[model samples]
Target: MATGLDANGAELFTLELARFNGQVVLRSVLRDANGLAERSAWFAIDPAQTAIEFAWQAAGTDAANGYLRLAVGSAFQVSGDRREPARLSGLRVLQQQGVAWVSLIGTGN
Candidate 1:
């Protein structure tokens, strides 16, 4: 699991990658339900210097779990994924908390 924080150092959300029924699932826990920009099941979070770009979408979308570019001290909900590029966000190894999976099998990048 990887935790993304805000400029104030508060826990904004967590990005987790897990294998379920032979498929990889990407989930997010926003600080509050209102933190999310839309009522979607998944998000493609691109971490940037000032904000985290989130692309909200339904579950089971293969392109949903690509790659994110977040660095830290990044605020959440600054931008919506509707206009951002579509890239599946990856879990940052260095920013992970809890049990880190050094080697994940079917997580297609």
Candidate 2:
């Protein structure tokens, strides 16, 4: 799980990776006054390239959308069609036993 913060360093959301059906997906939960609001769909992970690709429609809008092409390594890099509402600050990948865990920090815009 990852916690995302706003530009001023306030917690904005938490993100997780999970299995949905037979595919892996990214889940996001916004932290608001009413508590957490969760949103999840589909995303593609390319092990060969150590990258994740996803596109999500902006809330209450059909025209505005956000996309990400995140590369994972000792440090993370955003490339390709990357256009996110948040600014990434830090990322780290860790492995224990056979599971991989990703920690991300970002500034929500």
Candidate 3:
């Protein structure tokens, strides 16, 4: 799991990897101050690819208002509605060994 933060170091969202139906997927969750999920989405991660792109919206929303592109060894690229912009970018690999890693978002140059 990885916690994404804003420029001021406030928690904005969490990205986690989990197995569902025997397949690994990435889960992105945006939580409110009380830790309630505000919006969330799941994206399939392909180990053969260097990047993954996804879009999401709130439960009652008419359209997707959030988009994110994450690439290994590169900064995160995000774009979408102004009110729901992903304030975090970049990834810092704090620790890594083989396929496992500990990382932080928005902490890299």
Candidate 4:
């Protein structure tokens, strides 16, 4: 699967992966549907990353955030188990290698 942007990043479609194993340096940023990055995220994978669904919850209280896209590296791990999308002012668009990468951004609650 690939990415498809309708307009101004409003309607978006992409291959959502909870984990990555493509061995690529994934550069991520989050915003609303207005193309603005207020924060940044970084993830590194090797071809064995564990992918999961954003709506997935852990068996314990350490469940991932439902409003953010989580990433787990070989030695470091980033989880999006913050909360459901609660705010919306704009959107973010992150890319590496011109158009080769994977990303999952939260919209809003």
Assess the local accuracy of residue 55 in candidate 2 as a C-alpha lDDT between 0 and 100.
25
lDDT of candidate 1 over 1-109, digit per residue (tens): 5554434455445655556565544455544324553222443333223332233322234333322332224423322223222233443433346655433233422
**CA lDDT of 94 in candidate 4?**
47
Give the Å shift of residue 76 in candidate 4.
6.5
Q: In order, what lDDT does every prediction score?
A: 0.39, 0.43, 0.48, 0.37
- Total backbone collisions for each predicted model: 6, 0, 0, 13
Cα lDDT of model 3 by residue, 1-109, tens digit: 5566666565556566677897666666665545576444555565345544333322224444545344433424343342443355433332445543542222332
Residue 87 displacement in candidate 4 (angstroms)? 10
Shift of residue 26 alpha carbon in model 1, Å: 0.5
| Per-residue accuracy of model 4 over 1-109 as CA lDDT, tens digit each | 2333334434222223334564444433333345454333444545345542222222224433434343444334333443323323333434666774444544323
Q: 1 or 2, which is superior by lDDT?
A: 2
Residues 1-109 of candidate 2 have per-residue lDDT tens digits of: 5555546565445555677676655545554434555454434444345544222222223322434323333323222221234544433344578676753333334
Q: What's the best-to-worst order under TM-score?
A: 3, 2, 1, 4
TM-score for candidate 2, residues paired by index: 0.40
| Candidate 4 Cα misplacement greater than 4 A, ranges | 1-23, 52-66, 73-109
Q: Tell me which residue pairs clash in candidate 1.
A: 47-69, 47-70, 65-88, 66-88, 67-88, 67-89
TM-scores for every predicted model:
0.34, 0.40, 0.47, 0.32
